[model samples]
Target: MEVIQVKNLSKNYGALQAVDRVSFAVPEGSVFGMLGPNGAGKTTTIECIIGLQKRSGGEVTVLGLDPAISRKELYGSIGVQLQETVYQDKAKVFELCQLFSSMYPDPLDYKLLLERFGLEAKTRTYLRNLSGGERQKVAIVLALIANPRLVVLDELTTGLDPQSRREMWAYIKELQAEGRTIFMTTHYMEEAAHLCDQVCIIDEGRIVALDTVDGVIENAGMDTMISFETQDEIGMVLEKLPGVNRVEQEHEQVRLYSQKEDVLTDLILLLREHAVEYRKINISRPGLEDAFLQLTGKEWKEKVS
Candidate 1:
């Protein structure tokens, strides 16, 4: 089932077009990743879908309800955790959890949430005393506490430590197992690559690419990097090989880069035909970041920085 649907969605800030004619759908019980670089209209699109801001134009239906007209009903089914969340500096973790839980009907157990988040010890800690990662954990706990059918998480693991991030990913997978739909936004391509069933890449207020992680990666036309060590100087022979774009040789090693689908097979055959003995051969496929860069025409690091 399509839990979320958007068509011709547009949002504008005066003369500035924040989001332009964006469209996509999120299936039920799936992690839908909405990815874009800074100021790429991702945040604006999110706000519109969640009914936090009025959209300039479009059609949006989440869980069979229009967010504008059925906001109260929508809120009951969706749990939202914004990119930046703050609480009373003096508020205890338990207190904040208790407060949000009270707002929902038949909320999840706060004690279980604390245990699941490895935050039992910090239950008494004040919001001001918690580390950035700890504060993120608290926000996650509150968002999921309602046990809502749909969870919208922005920058879900932004400030988490390595271990904590992994833990949170595992928990999200568990939620998916329980048939909860997740709509998440993040700059972390690796996280989105691993967890998202469908990835939507937006840039400059438009939908640039939307597909499965593998599909997007393939659509980006990024090359696979193949590198190996060889004592022989066969650069001249390899250079003429099909699908070989560029080859760099450093001492006894040669790094080959190609975008051909059958580059690996061709490379191995060429090496055997030339009687080349290679060691430490490795092939690196294009990752989600590369795909994002290709779609947005922006360097991931530059966009984030």
Candidate 2:
């Protein structure tokens, strides 16, 4: 079943179009990733779908109801955690949890939530005294307390440590197991690749690519990367080589980008014929970041940084 659907969704700020004719569908009980660099219209599209921001054009439906018209009914079935969340600085950890729980029809157990989030020791700690990561944890706990059927998590693991991030990912997987659908926006390509059943790659408010993890890789024409150590700077005209698109130099290492699997083999044969001395030769398939860069023509560094 389709839990969320957006058709020709567009948002404009005067002359600048933030999201232009964006369209996608998120299935029920699946993790749908909305991925892009900074100013990609990802957040704008999300706001439109969630009915937090009015859409200038197009259609949006969440759980078979128009978000703009049926927002009140939809709120009960959806949990939302924005990128930036703040609470009363003087409130204690337990107090904040209890406060948010009261807003829900039947929230998760307060003690269980505290234990699940490793905040038991900090139960008495004031919100202002908590670290950035801990604050994020509290925010997430509040968002999920309702056990809503759908969850929209923007930058879900932004301030988490590696261990905490992994744990949160596990928790999200468990939520899906219990038949909850997740719509998430993230700058981390690896996170999307690992957790999302489908992803939509947005750039400048438009979907440049949308598909499964493997499908995006294939569609972006990112197949192989060849690397090896060389003694002399072998000025091989790699740009003219078949299936090779670009060549880059890092220190004394050469990395070649190509969609052809045979490019590495061909390079080895060429090196052997030319007596090019080298060591530590290797070939690797492209990762999610590689595919993302190829498709959107935007650097991940530009987003996360």
Candidate 3:
């Protein structure tokens, strides 16, 4: 069942086009990822859905109800976590959860939510004194305490360390099992790849790619990077070999790229012929990070550089 459907969604600010005719449907009880770079208009598209921002054109429906026309009804069924959260630092963690829960007609148990989120220990901690990760957990707890039928999370794990982030992902999986539909946005490709059942890749307010994580990889068909130890100046040898598109001698490692899995097979045979003593071989497939670059025409490496 489709819980959310957007068509020809367009949003603009003065002369700048924020979202341009983007269309996609999110099925019920699925983890949907809205992915893009910082200026990719993801937030604008999401805001349009939640009726936080009015669109210049297009239509948005959540649970078959139009956002603009049914704003109040929609809020009762949807939970939202914004990219940045503002709260009184003096408010105790448990107190905040109770306050948010009271606002909803049917809310989850505050105590259970706190324990599940590993926040019971900090129940008395003031919001202002919490670490970035801890404060994020508090925000998540308030969002979910509503027990909303649909949850909209933006950069859910932005400030979290790897361990806490993983724990939170696990919680989301649990929520899915309870049949809640989720629509979230994040720049963390790996997190989206692992958690999202379907992904909408947007850029400059337009939809670029929309599909399952595996489907996107299959579409790109980029070869993975494989590294191996080889002697015999494998540089020139592997360069002329089939299935090995590029070869370089970096210290003592030979790097290879191939869309075909047999690239390593041919490399091994050549190594045997040269009687080279190999240490180890490593192979990795192209991930969501690679797909993002290919679709956006942006070098992801440069971003980190």
**Judged by lDDT, which candidate is best?**
1
- Model 3 per-residue lDDT tens digits across residues 1-305: 89999999999899999999999999999999998878789889888999988889988889989998898888888988888765888899988888888888889999998898888999998888888778887887888887898999988887678888887788889888999999999878888987999998888888888999988876876877888775546678777778666766787887887777687788788788888877778898998888888888875531210
- Residues 10-127 of candidate 1: C-alpha lDDT, one tens digit per residue: 9989999999999999999999998888788877888889899888899999999989788888887788889877789899999999999899888899999888878999999999
Q: 165-255, model 2: which lDDT tens digit per residue?
A: 7877887887789899999988778889889999999988889888999898888876587888886666565666788888876767988
Candidate lDDT (C-alpha), each: 0.87, 0.84, 0.85
Q: In terms of TM-score, which candidate is strongest?
A: 1
By TM-score, the better pick of 1 and 3 is 1
Each prediction's TM-score against the native? 0.92, 0.83, 0.88
Task: State how far residue 82 of model 1 sits from its true place (Å).
Answer: 0.7
Error of 3 at 125 (Å): 3.2
**Model 3 alpha-carbon drift over 4 Å, by segment:** 233-253, 269-277, 301-305
Clashes by residue pair, model 2: none
Q: How would the candidate models be sorted by lDDT, starting from the highest?
A: 1, 3, 2
Model 1: how large is the Cα RMSD against the reference? 2.1
Q: Which stretches of candidate 2 lie over 4 Å from their true place?
A: 228-279, 302-305
Residue 281 of model 3: what lDDT?
89
Judge candidate 3 at residue 160 and give its lDDT.
75
After superposing all C-alphas onto the true structure, candidate 3 shows an RMSD in angstroms of: 2.9
